[model samples]
Target: MARSKGQTALNRAQIVETGLRLLNEVGLDGLTLRRVAKELNVQAPALYWHVGNKQELLDEMATAMLREMSGGQGSDPPGSNWQELLAQAGRGLRRALLRYRDGAKVFAGTRLTDTGHAEEQEAHLRRLVAAGFSPDAAARASFIVFVFTEGFVIEQQAVHPMPGERAPGYDVTERAEALGPEFPLAAQAGADLFGDYDARFEEGLSAVIAGIGATLGPRTQS
Candidate 1:
């Protein structure tokens, strides 16, 4: 059906906004152009005018999310040093990912093309370089923090086992029992191996920052 006169034509921003909402509702797998078009009351062809295909739509969705996650809102002030900067970014990334179901799953492998995202990343790297890290080390440290955050969030949001179904892999007790006395330490520790996620993330974030700090050695006079 053709849209009536005075009705708003679908645009890229509206399409992306609708796509993000659908992503949170049905996750990446269920998100499709037809679904978005239906939700927007536009024909599927209308959606193509904005986004070429499903993969292109996903790229836009991922870019929008990365822009938001990359401090586009300026929610917090810049950190004093690279360590503090990295810590803030790590926490921010995890918090942003947690906002949408399967957020990390959507973001992990996609490369962002948005200009805002590039600026945010540049700011982060500049802070690190200014804090005594060589450019190469700064880049590596940034990836380390990002990878750690993504990896941690993936496990944190792992599948929720349905009633009467087998528990997810995080259930250490099941695995420990399966191992029996042959792996005594594993049995004894049980779920303790996983530790508390919040505490573990903070500790791991600290360790990553500290490891990067160690690489700096002494701060050279600028």
Candidate 2:
């Protein structure tokens, strides 16, 4: 039953929660102020009082989701090494994004400044700095991890085939036959590269972590 007028009030959290639900149901494109308001049994204008506009709402929703994910793994256990910690974070982030359809799309380039999760990000940067990276390098490394994960997941989700569609990536077999003797290596490489996406992601992620570690110099552990 709908609440009476006096009890029918909306707040920012409520609006954000409702928006997240809409995103999960219809994804980013289908989410709208009207749909959110309707879900809450309130007028569209009522939502405006809480969120400035759709972009603002999306930003808050993204922030909330990220905060929740980061909160669950706030710190590494005592005595854990930095590489292990960073790897765990990378995998955690990927798993969080995979929980919702288009999650990477929702998160790509959404800054977390002053959004309640800034401290968490800062702590990560500080951890890198303590491991001997220059302040500037630490910042760049932090950004790179997010960028790599976002880009990787965006491509992964985009290419995932829907029902009745062929699997993702190329059909190199037919192409190899068409090319005949002209491009044997290219066709074989295509087939090899596209086969195991999970392994591909792990290999890339390990490479990225190693590259970042190299930038920290010999002081990475001390």
Candidate 3:
């Protein structure tokens, strides 16, 4: 239930964080404004002044999480060049989201669509443009990366037990059992698909960046 710096005692970020704590304990289905308020030792109405209703609280929590992913202003410190900076920024964002329990789910839900996360997108867009992309292309590519990463995170956390839910989780091999042997790849790689999300994420991201890099290769004089 940590609060943001420079925010009030009953700030939006604090309320959002309280919500996240509730999510961890009671889960999204069981989460409610009252539950969060009770945890924070405040009246629900007091939380409303800052965080609004449950849906808004969820979105704001997502925003707070994304900003936290952005880290301290200089945390992603620019490396030797824009390439390094872009990759470092990307890696920082990726690592931040991966650190929390259900980190991807929290981030994937309302984080990017919210206004606060737009700043992070804009910063990446600026870096991409400097790295030789047009504004539109940079923006598009960055969005793709965000979407892909979020989806990956959520899928990875799906096995997590929520309140009142029974799960140490199911077997991935259950699905593998259904596939026919003609699917040569599934016979070998099904486990890999359901497993090694971190490696899969990096592989996908590397492919994305490589494509972008190739597109912008070797600028020439007109």
Q: How many residue pairs clash in each candidate?
A: 0, 0, 0
Ordered list by TM-score, greatest first: 1, 2, 3
Model 2 global lDDT (CA atoms, 0 to 1): 0.73
TM-score of each: 0.79, 0.78, 0.72
Residues 160-193 of candidate 1 have per-residue lDDT tens digits of: 2111223257567677889898989868775654
TM-score-superior candidate, 1 or 2: 1
Better structure of 2 and 3 per TM-score: 2
| Best model number under TM-score | 1
- lDDT values of the candidates? 0.75, 0.73, 0.64
Structure candidate 1, residue pairs in collision: none
After superposition, the stretches of candidate 3 with alpha carbons farther than 4 Å from their true spots are: 1-11, 72-86, 109-123, 160-170, 173-187, 214-222
For candidate 2, the per-residue lDDT at 180 reads: 78
In terms of lDDT, the poorest run of 10 residues in model 3 is 160-169
For residue 78, model 1's alpha carbon misses the true position, in angstroms, by: 7.0
In angstroms, the error of model 3 at 113 is 10
Better of 2 and 3 by lDDT: 2
Q: What is the lDDT of residue 40 in candidate 1?
A: 89
Number of the top lDDT candidate: 1
